[model samples]
Target chain A: MPEKSKSSPQAIGYLYGRRTRIFSLLGLGIILILIIGIATSIGSVPIPLGTTAGILVDKLPFVEITPTWQDATATIVLDIRLPRIILAGLVGAALAVAGATYQGLFRNPLADPYLIGVAQGASLGAVIGFLLPAAWNLSGMGVIPVFAFIGAIAATVVVYFLSRVGKTLPVTTLILAGVALSALLGSIVSYLVISSGSKLHSIVFWMMGSFSGSAWSEVFLVLPYIAVGIAVIVIFARLLNVMQLDEEQAQQLGVNVEKFKIILLAAATLITAASVAFVGTIGFVGIIIPHAVRLIWGADHRFLLPLSILTGAIFMILTDLVSRTVLAPTEIPIGVITAICGAPFFLYLLRRRKRAIF
Target chain B: MIELEMRNVTLGYDHHPVMEDVTFKASPGEVVGLIGPNGSGKSTIIRALSHLIRRKSGVITVGGRDIEKIKRQELACLLGVVPQLPLLPSTFTAFEIVLMGRNPHLGLFEAESRRDFEITRQAMARTGTGKLANRHVNELSGGEIQCLLIARVLVQETQAILLDEPTANLDIGRQEDILDLIKNLCRENNLTVLAAIHDLNLAAQYCDRLILINDKHIHAQGTPAEVITNANISRVYGAENCVFTHPVNGLPTVLLSALKKKEIGRNTISQR
Candidate 1:
């Protein structure tokens, strides 16, 4: 009889644990749909929430749409809102996924997509593109993004090599080196901003981050990278968990640690480069979203990586909506909104999981 | 009967040799303890044998197959290890941590099978950690965490186990518990165990044979009673100690030789 009671508690505990995981995933899914719908409904001319869903349904294959092609509702949904919403979702997912990958690759919870100074480097390049006299003529020609992508790659490479003193790169020292590089690059970017006084506003806006400039072209450009990056991360997720043990253990477990590190870091860097090229330096999404997901879901990378992507997409769309509608005609930079939202959450996470901060 | 053999093995880092000409063998159902003074290359020997670090020149063979010829996973399947003060990833639950033992068995891109879970569960039960299955490993006490690590190795289901100071950091009770667990597991499973133990008495009590290392060389190798002697202890460890038998088990034990009574200081007398 006593044994039965003891086993009963064990069985009940197992069931409860499984139930919570399911509930969390279901909750994230529901929030994602709601955020996408609400974000699509927001803008200068607010569309009804129902119309947003109807528009999405109309675009789906098997749904019969009797609405005329020339209808104002159809045009607003298909041409404008659809692309913007899709862009927001993709960028958010990309940033979040990139953040998760970097965190795992570094094996540091505090690490994010911005850890290797990629975002700062990309921001510097964007500033250079904006401040240059030729930028006025080169605007909308994809020059800014090209420069930004190059800057990100260069900065990450520098961080990578500088951190490798010999055969072994201690994680703490690597982080410190990355922080130093970020500061140096940041100062150089600030100098560029000050030197080009007339173009300072444009440069600052780009640095602050924004999705206001997102168009179908930028979205399409980033989509391939995001898809590829996510696929690479998903494929390597279990291998990353293996690496959480010492390198020797990971090797014994059939992971090529050096090869995996190179591939994972490259994929993460590619995602960040593609993302910042289009949306500027949107802070907090990449860093905070993955950690938040981890806090709730635990560290099964199989679940954490995909969940982070979904949550990140939803988070960005919601933040972008707030950025656009907060001040009717003039939009606040999406970076500002994300920072203002993310800093508090970061502090809360740090406070709640003080031991995990390190 | 020799399952694993290391012959004239040399190991070091970056062309600098730490230990050389180290040779040993552990046959099936035998417990061999490697005992040495600090820096005598006990860990270096284990690392070389496990292929965690490369050996400069030696022939290491498992089941008549050369160690170098075996793939990493295949080797892992042949031997499981319990490292000294293993640093574990904190985020995983006890079950998840144990389930990783199946990595050698898992196909790339394939999930763990139900059989894997059953094995993990049985390991946890054997280690008396089934109650903590759902708990995060980071939250466990040192003793509990050590058991979970042992459980992980058990789930690996290797024919041999290599333990490096597995109980070095535990309290006396926990150390005894872990040692007993390892001894029983090896006995029941007929496992070949090569353990690096610092406590000479514990090694004397449990090991079927002892290999004493001093200055990167084997000082003595035989039964505990044969290898652990006043002459060998004073020579190898540079310590003056007396040998005695355990009261219950009648195993050889050591006591440090005391100085003459006249040499005792007046301050020591006053303190006593």
Candidate 2:
């Protein structure tokens, strides 16, 4: 074929240019590090920035510095604050990426990590684990998360199969099925919570969501699941971009829509189930973080996923800090803080754009 | 030369068969138009050929290889489809949407290379969509989106192209421009083109062979002059005295008119 003569139309450049994207990524990275440092220093005890850095460095292998800070300060920073911060970051990043993936897969801006009954299912399982005799709890690797993961995958599978009409998976039907199943599972969880005689307070606390007792063990437990899930999602980021089009169009473009959907749903659900298993259901991070990223940067998943990870970590760290210090001796539930901070900002963004953010 | 052939193919959703025992062949360097009424399964045929929907029985082959046996990427490399109405993400730029056509050519982990960008850009230029590259798909007009879809198909660079109502939303000038582009591409690249067109005149003008479908089967298949006769149009389309040859090309065209009172009265009497 003969080449068509090109008449330039005064190039408008990319909507999100490469240079701007890279710079935003680097800037967010630096900001995240700074926020972590600042956040570690500002908790209830109010450790000095220098002392915090010294404690962190001292813990690093082969770089042992003399303990300049009090032993109590070291214990508080290393044993409590660090683990809580890291777990909060992991859970936030996991939820945000999972939310983004769900949004892209369903082609609905309203889609969140819990859209397909994962939360209710995990809650039901966790409640069951809580009610069980303390004998079932494995050493450090609690039985609740394992049951939650199983419950989450099973509920999603059920919803997926129920909503499928022949080979087509209609988004509306899927959402309806998820809602129905979620209500059913939620009732079961409530019933379980009511019947629990002595575990009521702890169960309710877990349900309300907290990182109060988060330990390095819980952090280590969630790290692999979130890391692996995020890696898989990032690998398929471009395909996820193509999937923003209707399923038939994606299929015509050589995407095995059904297979891709299954893989993505599994990965997103796994990370979400893992995150919620320990931290309870932290709301708003899944929905608000992705929307905020899309509002500032475009909806391209290549950028959306990584940007969500960074911003989600930062947002969670900041929110956790507020939850710790806002009421001082009485820390608020992190869920309450996220919703309080996230919902208003999200509404502001939606009103400002007044256009389709997806 | 690649040929798209569907032999004894039956397609439908669930248990209800829409088109049964359909057989046809679109050869290289030829344009075949599927002309039918609104519900005559024209789009179903296109979908089945693209493997967007499965055929119940028989086989669809591209370049003498069964489409079912071909992997999705390989099938996409062989055939490109422009859906009648495609839902695109509103936020995506035309450039990004067009660049996605290169997906079939790339490996699973491979991002678009410089060469792929060049090809996509060249396609946009050819289809006159370069000016719209930076614009969001949601902001584009219907004709602009149609042109972008065509540009995307061009970027695919397949051996066979399937289009469902390729010019459904275009004005007269753009309709001709798009058809002319497809024709030129067919001739130059030796690509087989199969398009489902509602406009009888346009089908007759552009298609080397026209397949008229009625009542879930192929009613007639031949050159425009042979297949689009007055008797065939009246019998299949239930329109009497509408067929006429185009003055410019001497190809068959249909002239439509409002239903007369006498015809309505006669039809009422017949019903009674």
Candidate 3:
């Protein structure tokens, strides 16, 4: 490479751009809280802010709200809002962390959980459940998540081994392998759906992503996977940062790059699989939320991973609210709302990053 | 004390050996230059020493401990390497890039301490890159990024530093600056430096000992004056060059013999 002229503009002073990022994150957090409070309050039956607060306060272990307000808000808040908010938060965080880790692990900003075949596999599993008469009997409506989780894990393993041709797992080859595998899994899912003529509607609706079936029991089921995944990623943040360098350099620097890669892959697969199991396949949340956080917080996985978790939670809660209200009584799929919101933002980023390689 | 020693070492890709029975020692407070033509196994020597690639046979010792017996983190604490081309993504700052040197000292969930920050700062200061500390590493000029990579090794604070063609892509001024910086670091800190240098003149200028490699063997090994003679240059590199003392530094240097293209072309044409 020839030396550039000294008179050219230098890429310094980029650190000062943090102020806007800090303010934006704060603003986003506030908006998240407002959306959760307001959206949850305006459901099939409207609950006033006063009543919502009363129900919320009463649920706290130590809080004692006034009798009248608690009675008015109890069923709406406890039976509906609490589960929905918790589910939204968990799903959002799960998707976001998965996105950030994938981006860092692959050393490509555009990589997401869905890009590596997790979503496709989960969708396939959901379709499989839809086809089986046993699964449809509602005797095993509860088993959908289990099937989806297993499918996701299987997809991740296939992609990983397909990319591992002997000692080196070149980034380009891995990404190409992922795309191919995703297409294969996607076709299988479509075939299953098409074959189940009567059950096609259920499969299609689930693929679109929804929170309509979320309940307190489902929330508990998904919580442990998301929590464990988040903990594992946070603990391994520093190791993930080291992995951005070439594998030889990273190994020489004392990182067990192969082991770390496996750990990250397993954690990311667990979270995405679990989140998609019950919530259906939510598009854009995994790809969009992490990118928004990274653009705000820089790419040190230590901070980026945690911040993405929070930002993801916020983004999902708000998007779910929009899905619920956009078509009153109709309850639009959350996936539809996220795609409509995320696609334009993604395009804007793509345009800005025309020359910027991550 | 011997900081690094390779004895009867053999290296290869998988099962086939590329180089055999190589022996060398880098004692504390000396800089050893590994010089050779392209594909002469210079980079392989660095890789084998750093444990980036497995050795086919023989023993490597660091600080009197067998390299194979040392754990990865333990080996890292004693040695560090600066690759020919350091990779940096657009998102990493110079400070963060240097901080990665602390990996050997950190636990799985550890955060950077004040001591770690101080060491990173000192490294930046030593490499004359403190002003660029917060700047994105990938956006910097090649020379600037090379300096930052050296700074990262400095932060590692290892007793031995291995460099593979560190100045290969640098301009003349930057090359001189980097070589001088490396010499100063070795002298001041008692660092055992083994650098694979492409420029023979630069190696002759800074290295206390030169090991000439060709055709997967040590062609010659001696002081610069003994190893950099015209006979050696012609035999090893197939270049018709005159050996002379550098006018200012009084060091052995090579001056290529003149050969007009028409004269060489006509000779080859006649022979054919």
Candidate 4:
């Protein structure tokens, strides 16, 4: 008897050009836009959706819309809310993509962006920057973000060196080294926090992660690094999929296992460090957003990477919106909002699926 | 088709040699089965052969060129492997997993083309896994995943194939089906094939030749009749196993001897 693929047309859809996958991505793109609009419209002054659309449309080069809104509202929308939202989206995207990358690289579903001590190192760097002389601020760039980036890179380098036995960097060794370093750096950060006299409040707030004073300059600063990192990762998406298998299998299929792991680990860490530099140490987004995206779309990293970006952005924007509005003039740390909101929703997804998210 | 040759190869982990000076060759259009005991380095041999492990003391070559001199991408195009019990991401559909076989053929920046998809579809169909295309890998049984792995290697289009415990997780009937598929493909395509199979009988039946590994080396190598003798089986496996002639094919078949079945009276041993 001849063996033929007589599976239904839907099965062919899975094997071939993924039409539905593309359409769904386009749909998510629209959802991202709507979320951006909503995030911008519903601030303290409460700009209407129509006015928000008009103000946004006027900014487009080819198209001009009459600015019926007041200059105050325009300033509030573009300068304040827009940049803040954009920064949140960027941080969210960076963490989510990095988280997904780490999860794939480690071949463990529990792996998160912060698994390798990026958050602890960045936080320690920020605290040291705070404790140092104010003259360390360079070129109007805040000392904390720069120091945080350096700290993150330094911490990862140490971990990498510590874990490497030879040419190969085993994933388990890297993870163990990271956990050990995180504990050390975390203690130093806490000790510094207790000793700091006046800057205690600011340091604690930064540790909790906030988008309170985001500016267009900060958004533009991190955007290039985050974009480049995510692009490099997406380019390796196919190889990353192969890496879901064990190292031996991956190498048998022609991937240079050690080199590929290093490249991805570097890319993920770079984005993660950049995100943490400006955003303090936001947690949960790195772990939860990937799960959320995997819950809806399958775990193909090609889609998973890009969709995680969009889903992460929308989720953070919404979470930040709640962080500001729920307290009504009193600001809460974005990290707190994420934990409160993300945990239950993540639990809901886990319970509903009742199986592996990876 | 490519020739896979291992000359005095010694493989190990962390400077500890697991297998020493192992030499074997699998020619095109031939299936060579590696038979050994539980810890006799069967998997280690496959790993070294595929260049997945560094050989401490000797050379392994593909098509007359040293594998160490070959670039990873080129090597991948020449050899494909089906490893034992590889973990697949739970959410990846079977088609997507099979589609990954095209990675070596694709450029770094290139996405999977339509032709790649067609090849994957055909491979899955041939492996009798077409219905599994839309199903997630997590939902599949171990046997089904093993079959899917075979399909992946088929789409890989390598001149040489290495299989590590290919039938370890399969049922009885599927075992024959997989071996038959491998044998037919090897002959049809004139591909060099090497499989590490635990079942001495199946290995003896399907393989053109058998290499018995013991004490971290090739203990015996020849035609199945020569390699699967009762003396060799007992020596390598440390068991008084019997090798019977297959009535239909006139090949050697191994049957493990029972450990002298004695009727156990419930109270026979020192009952008060």
lDDT of 2 by residue, B1-272 (tens): 69999898889888998998899999999999999899999999999989988889988998998888988878888899998867789988999999899999988789787788788888888888887888889999888899999999999999899999999999999899899999999999999999999999999999999999988888999899988998898788777878887898888888875442235456665676
lDDT for residue B84 in candidate 3, whole number 0-100: 87
Lowest summed lDDT across 10 adjacent residues in model 1 chain B is found at B257-266
For model 4, the stretches where C-alpha displacement exceeds 4 angstroms are: A5-17, B239-241, B258-272
In candidate 4 the C-alpha lDDT for residue B52 amounts to 76
TM-score of 3: 0.90
Q: What's the distance in Å from true for residue B116, model 2? A: 1.9
Q: After superposition, how far is residue A71 of candidate 1 from its true place, in Å?
A: 3.5
Q: What order do candidates take by lDDT, descending?
A: 4, 2, 3, 1
Q: What is candidate 3's lDDT per residue for A58-108, written digit by digit as tens?
A: 777988866675454687688777798889999999999998888888888
TM-score rank, highest first? 2, 4, 3, 1
In candidate 4, what are the lDDT values of residues A35-153, reduced to their tens digit?
A: 88889999789999988888887897999787788998989989999999999999999999999999999988888988888888898889999999987778877899999999998
Give all candidates' CA lDDT scores: 0.79, 0.88, 0.80, 0.88
TM-score of candidate 4 against the unseen true structure: 0.94
TM-score of 1: 0.90
Rank order (by DockQ, best first): 4, 2, 1, 3
- Where model 2 places Cα greater than 4 Å from the true spot, the runs are A1-12, A57-67, A164-169, B257-272
lDDT of 3: 0.80
Per-residue CA lDDT of model 3 for B1-272, tens digit only, reads: 34888888888887767788888888888989999889989999998888877787888888988888888777777899998886677788887888788888787767777688777777777676777777777669988888878888888888899998889878898788788888888998899999999888999999999999888788888889988988888778877656889999989987764442233456665676
Between candidates 1 and 3, the one scoring higher on lDDT is 3
lDDT, candidate 1, at A358:
19
**Chain B TM-score against the true chain B, each candidate:** 0.92, 0.95, 0.92, 0.94
Question: Better model by DockQ, 2 or 3?
Answer: 2
Instruction: Give the runs in model 1 whose Cα sits over 4 Å from its true position.
Output: A1-19, A68-70, A131-141, A165-170, A246-254, A345-358, B64-69, B171-177, B247-250, B257-272
